[model samples]
Target: MTAVAHTSFVIERDFLASPARVFRGWSELALKQRWTDCHSDLAGRTHTLDFRPGGSETVTMRFPQGGTCVVRFHYFDIVPDRRIVYGYAMELDGRAGSVSLVTVEFAPTPAGTRMVFTEQAALLEEGQDLAERIEGTREGFDRLARELEPAPARP
Candidate 1:
């Protein structure tokens, strides 16, 4: 029998930008591509986003070694520059792998914006575990930090 495990985790980060700017990084398509895995070195990869309540986002990438992985996100609630709640599922080569509900809250700080991310997930026996997911998420956020950096003014 296949086993299903449940887990939840939270990560918080502060950005040196306004809450609106930070929120735009997630809501804007071009900006999101800079931080997310939309630029992976995969063949036949595609990413589409519709950032609104009840909207959906999908990303598919085929690994060079073998197999394809797909992630689909369905937005449940969105409060511009404040909060977002979404549910997502992962599939490996057309087989169901895992499902998760995620919540992100943005708050204004004296210096900039603070974001709190919470994810509750169910892992299938054949899928990755919570620790791996956490690590990947941390790496993604690290990339986001770089993406959020301001560009230098042209001479």
Candidate 2:
């Protein structure tokens, strides 16, 4: 029988943008796609996001070395620019891997916004690398910083 390993983690970041702007990064399909899987090395990727309660988001990535990783997020609750709760999971090479319940809360800060991300996950047998997951998320947030930048002036 395969064993299941469970883990939980919280990641927080301060962005120099309003809560609405930060929420837009996750709620807009095209914008979300820009920062979603930026941390991964991929040969190709396709993303779809419905961005509403009961809707689902999916990202399929093909690796250069020959493997496919599919990630899915099912939105359960959304509070506009305040919070979002979702179910997250991963499938790699046809094998179901980790399943997670994720909650993201956004609050106004003195400078801009503080975003807190909390995730509780159940990893399938041969436990997924928790560090990799955390590091990958950190990297994604780094890329998201670009999303917070002010738009360049257009001539």
Per-residue lDDT over 1-155 for candidate 1, one digit per residue giving the tens place of the 0 to 100 score:
78788889999999888889999988988878767874366766778999999999998888887899999999999999999999999999898889999999999999889999999998875657678789888888888878887797999
Model 1 lDDT at residue 127:
50
* Residue pairs with backbone atoms closer than 3 Å in model 2 (clashes): none
Model 2 C-alpha lDDT per residue in residues 86-110, reported as the tens digit of each score:
9988999989999999999999999
Error of 1 at 15 (Å): 0.5
For each candidate, give its TM-score against the true structure.
0.93, 0.92
Q: Cα deviation of 115 in candidate 2 (Å)? A: 0.4
What is candidate 1's CA lDDT for residue 76?
99
TM-score between candidate 2 and the true structure: 0.92
Task: Give per-residue lDDT, candidate 1, residue 145.
Answer: 79
Predicted model with the maximum lDDT: 2
